[model samples]
Target: MLRLGSPRRRINIGLIGMTFVLSIFAGRLIQMQGLDTKVYETAAANQRTQIEEIPAQRGSITDVNGHELAVTVEAREVAIDPSKVPAAVRQKIAAILGRQLGKSEQEMAAKLAKDRTRYQLLARDVDPVVATRLLQAGVPALSTKKTYRRLYPAGDLAGSLIGFVGDEGNGLGGMEQAKNTLLAGRDGKQRVETGRDGQQIPMTSSQRTEPVNGQDVRLTIDRDIQWAAQRSIAEQVRKSGAESGTVIVMDVQTAQVVAMANAPELNLNDWRRAPAASYVNKAAADVFEPGSTNKVITAAAALEAKAVTPDTVYQVPDNIRCADQVLRDAHAHKVESMTFRQAMAQSSNVATVMAAREIGSQRLHTMLKAFGFGSAPGGGVPGAEAGLLPDYKKWSGSQNCTVAYGQGVSVTALQMASVYQTIANGGVKIEPQIVAGTTDTSGRYVPAAAGKRTKVVSETTAKEIATMLESAVGVEGTGQLAAIPGYRVAGKTGTANRYDAELGRYEGYTASFVGFAPADQPRLVVLSVLQKPKNGHFGGQLAAPVFKDVMTFAIKSRKIPPTGSAAPQVRMRAGQ
Candidate 1:
């Protein structure tokens, strides 16, 4: 204490230390405000600017008459800014939102408790009106985003045909999946400047890329006909206790699909509840033997090749032998002398086999290919299968005879209907079509390109088959149940042994009826199919009634009057 320094020296030392500290701070300020100025400015801009994605509206699906099947409606996504919400009031606000949005209070509270997060989703796909009412509560940090949600207005009317969308708004099945690209438009983007509170800064620079909305798809389906077909098939499937069923109706002249219906169909609005198999359009997807319905092809091949005529006599017994197997008719009968027309009208398997032999294996195979078998039917339908048709060269000895009677070969309901449509169209086969066209950006309707056309047989051969089909619907024929009063009808019934893949054997029968109305001037073709029927397994008994109900409504709905021409007389028996 006695040897202290002078006052001037102490004062000078303190000033020097103060000057050093001030110089260090000055240098740091120069570096930050001048040398790294651009860096700091960029960081500030990044904090204020925000980018957002804008979802595009999905397109609509409509029937031929402008009925909505699938549509998009305005919706909102409710969210919260957890970081901005006060901890004391978080639970209260969450409870209010939970009640209004149908969410659990605890879940909403947990989302609100994420204090570090700026955004937390409360609910997606909320109704706009509900969202508006939710905001009227004036809860702090609550927000709503504009969005769109899919709606199936017709319920399950065309559920499987129209299909459903996923959570991300992508098509999942049916026409929705087949034409997804055209239906799902491109999304857009937007960039805007915001303030510290996360609110957009007014009058600030903003950037946006406009979204391209999806185009509307129009189908050839008639709503009324589709309803009738679906109702009738569903009822028949239940009454017959079958595993499944299908019905298809087409315009003979245009080859346009008027109605496609399946039992146990998917409900578009609630598709998750349905089984996966029900999601398929079975009419165009399922494959099975056509049984007697396929005899028309043999008849066509024989008539076209001049192998046999309608009056050709056959001494048919109840059964015939081929290779190691013996085939029999539907019912046991003694050897009978019948003309070709009578054999057809009676659904004689033996007679069909004899005619197939006249045409030979190669000629019959050629005729099958010409009729659109063993090929995928492209009609803008999803899961359209190319039915199985083994080459004649690959046919086993038994298969040759079996294929002649529609055993070894397989075909879809649509393919079989197309065959009848070809006959009804005077022998010209047109590719079946479901989609009529799509609307342009300007909202103008544009028709699709015409389907491919091929001449399958001569007009004369078609007329001969038509007459033969008419005999099958006559009073004495197996398909008499399919006849309509005052209308000339032509049809064939099918009852085939159903091959059960799961059981690894033939367990039941596939009953089907394919036919056309106004036989003199065909206008419509209808096909009905029932698989694994427990109550009954005859096509004429099980499937024909469904065809009759659907066909009667179709003719009446289309206002198709009878041709009023008398049916031509034909020889049923050889000596008649």
Candidate 2:
């Protein structure tokens, strides 16, 4: 039916077709091995290579004595390669993980059931010991990653001051937040090739970058003093049934805050469970009417301006009228001629107002500013507030007189303590400092600059006021309970009406006592404050005792010997 092709022709055509197909295959091989080699190789390398982050260790936070307060310790991240785990053992592995990691069995089971994935994170920040036990269980595909966890060795000691870190290893508050940049070092990276089984190929070419650990922060806080302050404040707060309390102790010469304690302190190890209020460093952050404690400022202004002497007589009455307001003394008494020292010792509102008139409002306001009021105390403390102080020109007639006796104004405990520190240090006001210095990654110590000092009053004025303050702690004075055995104490007691911002009205009282020990040669200043105490509300009764206890411990701990000089005689009444 048809002519058949020659056998040679058929063979030649078959060979030609085979050769064309073979040529295509050869070209593809050449392209992959040469022209497009890098593209293909990169694709393969990306699949087999993994880049892991190397966490840099956070720096340590230590007390002045090198006591470790906050530190970073070795930890692990537990994970699983679901693809390597057998289906039968998935449930068993989930059971072990749940028991150790505190996760629900159902949750771990769901994670382990992901057979298509190579990695599933189980838990992070696991203790190394616990992670080792997990790996020892012999579960396939379970692995532990090297990591770090923040540890607070001192527990809640100086918790609010040292602050805490977040899950991302960043500081959130306190000195930790203020100096976070120095505390968080640079992280590094590592790249290594792995086999299909997700195991690192030994001896393979890999790149690694070394991490730079954070710098250590050394604070000026004395650990023993901080502990004592916390203990005393916490005990008194509970005993007095107060809403809150704060205590601050400062080195008079250096203005270094040895101890700053607040009641209901936040525990650094368990910060997440604490209330929001506990996170506040109340000593520096909270502001309130300083009451009679503010009288010291008035006294400083009057004495400095030469408006009144310690023996200047004032006919103090039970009540006095200024503008549209009538101000009364804390106690009811008939008109009496009293020396300026006696009026101050008795905390007579009438006498203070009468004395304030001698200097007028302008001189008084100037003295307040000079004493560091209406300004933030810069000591590297986070959330340190500048208490409110209105201008003297804006003062109403009543405010003029009220402000003279520690009303119509607000101040932080730290600022008030600084005022006394100025007097204690012979009129030189030094900025309060909490951070002593920082230790760098290279292990070199870098000290912070000394606090800025400004002279507020002459040494003569300071000494004279110091003697008057001593008389206030005498038997007839309101601050009698503030006296320590074998030590001449000088301080003022305050009981101001609390102004509740929420209610927009005045309610309750802020009882406080601020003073320094060894009146003739003050070395340390201690201030104790309580807000709205339900049990007792007098500064002498509630706050003064706390001051005496804390000061006693601080002086003894620092080995500050009392000055041998006896207290000079201060006339309370006009006639001796």
Candidate 3:
């Protein structure tokens, strides 16, 4: 304020003020370096470090014979940094990528025009060889990431069973959906310091967690047998002009499902192209009336209740009144007295109803439940249906008689196969198994738990019923087409009228045949069903030959020796 000095003194004062400003700046720098050093270091590390995920390797799915059904193959994803491409070369780059990736030049150019986007996907699931070619093209902005794509080497052979995965690498159907958790392993993370170019910096601190590969899943399905079943069913369905078909082959002793095939199947490698209905597993999902094939249940119930023997005589006619309903034999016949065995071999509806009437409602219902009907197979099969079975208490007078001849009751093809499996297994019901088990990291197989077993009928009654079935497949009976040369076959044919909901009445039929070969010592139970056949509607005419073809292949493929004995003869006439 009292500045009465020269200009040099004023300059000295200005210099002192400048020194104070410099001292304040030095104090601030010291505080930042010492007191707030951790804050700045954290910000710097965050800017230069990144956490990346490492995908786990998915496991393979194989048949019982070790044939690869589904596998994960190495693939690549091609991406580009739009901002990294120079404007002068952008057009040329887009053209080159368009040609390599099978895309239009305009589309590639539009993607490259987004300069603000650092990363843009050019192609996904590119074959490794093709990705290598694109990488070698010397495009600076282009980059590739390692990935995996699922492949089905067997194509649509077991597509419905093996199932497919979604774009996000998750299971979408069949065993894929059922065993997703076991097949998809946990992913890992890695923290890495990066450079300005987004490359891993050398000698930088890092942390990593290793990924665990998924466990392999092995199924009980046999490749050759499955193919045989599929081919046979497809040929039969198409040749017969049927809507669809299902074939199931089960091991008689172990109840292991060797082959489950459906016709008009979708290709697993391209499931999206197929119709939605093709996704269903009809063998386990759909249900149909057993028709004459259910006659076996009536016989078993009668035999179990000690109401009749295999040779018990009954006077059956062309038609008989059962409560308020009239049940008729498949063919026109005169009134004749026939033994229960002869009646069964002839598939006589009147005879079966007469036998069931002796067993009554309670015992018949018990036998049906014991045969694994009215309940799901319950081996963890997805979409398994517990077919319709009204309680005995809910049975009307006609319902009992109609159910006796397989009119009112319904069952899945698998359940029907299991019913015969119980008979083939000496009246012991064993649950069917599809998945054998998962494989360990060391490639060791761990078998699945044994299936549940329960006794449904005495061994003697089962053999007696088996003998009756063999007679049905004999030259004199209705199922003569089911007999195999050199091996006595035991089975029954069924032709059930399919109800038309729109018309509210029966319009079409489901022709089916379930049988086991080498009648003396049953080994395999094969069941085939065709829906709405235009060529032939009888199970013996349409479904039996398919069953025979599949069974012949199964017998030879399994190396099952013949019984070396003729089928047991049963008298078809009143007096033989």
Candidate 4:
């Protein structure tokens, strides 16, 4: 059926036609496939195989006993690729996205209308219910993807301590910020080859890197004890009408921080409503003049120097003068000369000043430093403050008297707790710790090192001090409010008036109490500081009760077996 051209004419015509057609085809192919490949191929990949980040699930945070503190949950993020959408459906796409995201359609449309950006985030951390609804609708240009979102299982139980993450999964405070690098995992990429009809090229996948999941962190906190301490403090804060309160508990044996609770906590899951102060860990941050609590150091120094004995009786006096300073007790009674034990039991400021004066500045400074004064607790967290303690050479005539009763120096709640813990642990002052351990991918834990210990006082001296503390908590002492029903308590009450610099005088007072319970065998050490309490200003009336409540709750929560014993008595040296 083919028609053959005239021999001469057909050859020339056919050759010319074939040359023109071949040249046209080659030019069209190069233009459509080479220079334009990037744009077109990207478009094709968008439909069939997206260039996306595959996020690994962040690890969990647990308490020392494997109690869950913070965990991760799957969340959905909705996005829109506006350029791929048909212009006619723009209004519909905007309406659907905006309503689902709690935004205005006009605002969403304006964002999607941008030509420069290929992808626009419509909503992040969307609830699964909304994500399901959006996905079911399947509006053009809209897409939903899965992501790992942090969640607090304990609510506000340990909120401030555990901390929370931000929208970009970055930590902002607490342990979240401290362990961010370990919590956030590495991301990965994939470039899958696609077939002609927008179908993924199966079995020809390209995955360049694998995601490395974050490590798990465990804290030294005991959840039950933490809950108990927090609840007790909250109850007391409400009942007493104090401005604010803080309580910290450390183990007598290990010196590990069992619980640190502050009132007005921020929710670990929802920190937006939290006040700035709510994020502050007051136990380790706020410093206050440590009233009569400082007397213990003075007493210990005198004991170490053999300056006085439990029965080394002193003459009775209504008041005493340390150079220009006049020292007196809360209640005045000119009794016949009382023994040193009786003087400590009555919490006589004059007696404490005398003890400090006898010990001298050098011995006092050594004892204070040994008690972890003028130093950081070194918990490895940011914002730790080292409280103030003047050196030995800095002591003047009145310095010994004022510092003896906790007036001249300042200390944080943590530092004060360490002071009490030292006495409880047989004079071995252990550094306080917050973090317990961090575990790698294999779930094997690497425990944090136990804090260093320093032997500050002798066991006999520690026992003597414990005996005096016991008398202080018994029938006729200032710390009577700190006694637990079933066990003996050893504690000191502090009532230091806040010094006003502008007015050059003391105005209000800060009430605090630091002590250990079950005096025979120490189970817990509790430090309670109530700032500017409106109802009453005495440490005995305010802070002592708070310490009692916290200590009782902590002991019960830890299920410490009650030794069920009577208080111990200190033996005075013969013929002192």
Listed in order, each prediction's TM-score against the native is 0.94, 0.95, 0.93, 0.84
Clash count per candidate:
0, 0, 0, 0
Task: Rank by lDDT, highest first.
Answer: 2, 1, 3, 4
RMSD of each: 2.3, 2.1, 2.6, 5.9
Regions of model 3 farther than 4 Å from truth: 1-28, 86-91, 102-107, 500-505
lDDT of 1: 0.91
lDDT of 3 by residue, 55-143 (tens): 77778889997789999888888999999999999999999989988889998999999999999999877888888888898987788
In model 2, the clashing pairs are none
Work out how many backbone clashes candidate 4 has: 0
Comparison by TM-score, 1 against 2, better one: 2
Candidate 1 TM-score, C-alpha based:
0.94
State residue 450's C-alpha deviation in candidate 3, in Å.
1.9
Instruction: For residues 43-123, write the lDDT of model 1, one tens digit per residue.
Output: 988888999879888899999998989999889999988998899998889889999999999999999889999999999
Give the per-residue lDDT of model 2 (tens digit) for 1-576: 998879999999999999999999999999999899999999998888999889999999999888999999999999988988888888888889999998999999999888898899998889999999988989788889899999999899989989999988899999889888899898899999999776899988789999899999999999999999999988999999998999999999999999999997889989999998888888889999999999888998999989899899998899999999999998999999999989989999999999999999999999999999899989787789999899999998899999988889999999999999999999999999999999876889899889999999989889888888898899879999999988989999999999988889998999999999889888999999999898989999999999999999999999988787788766778768
Model 4 accuracy (lDDT, Cα)? 0.80
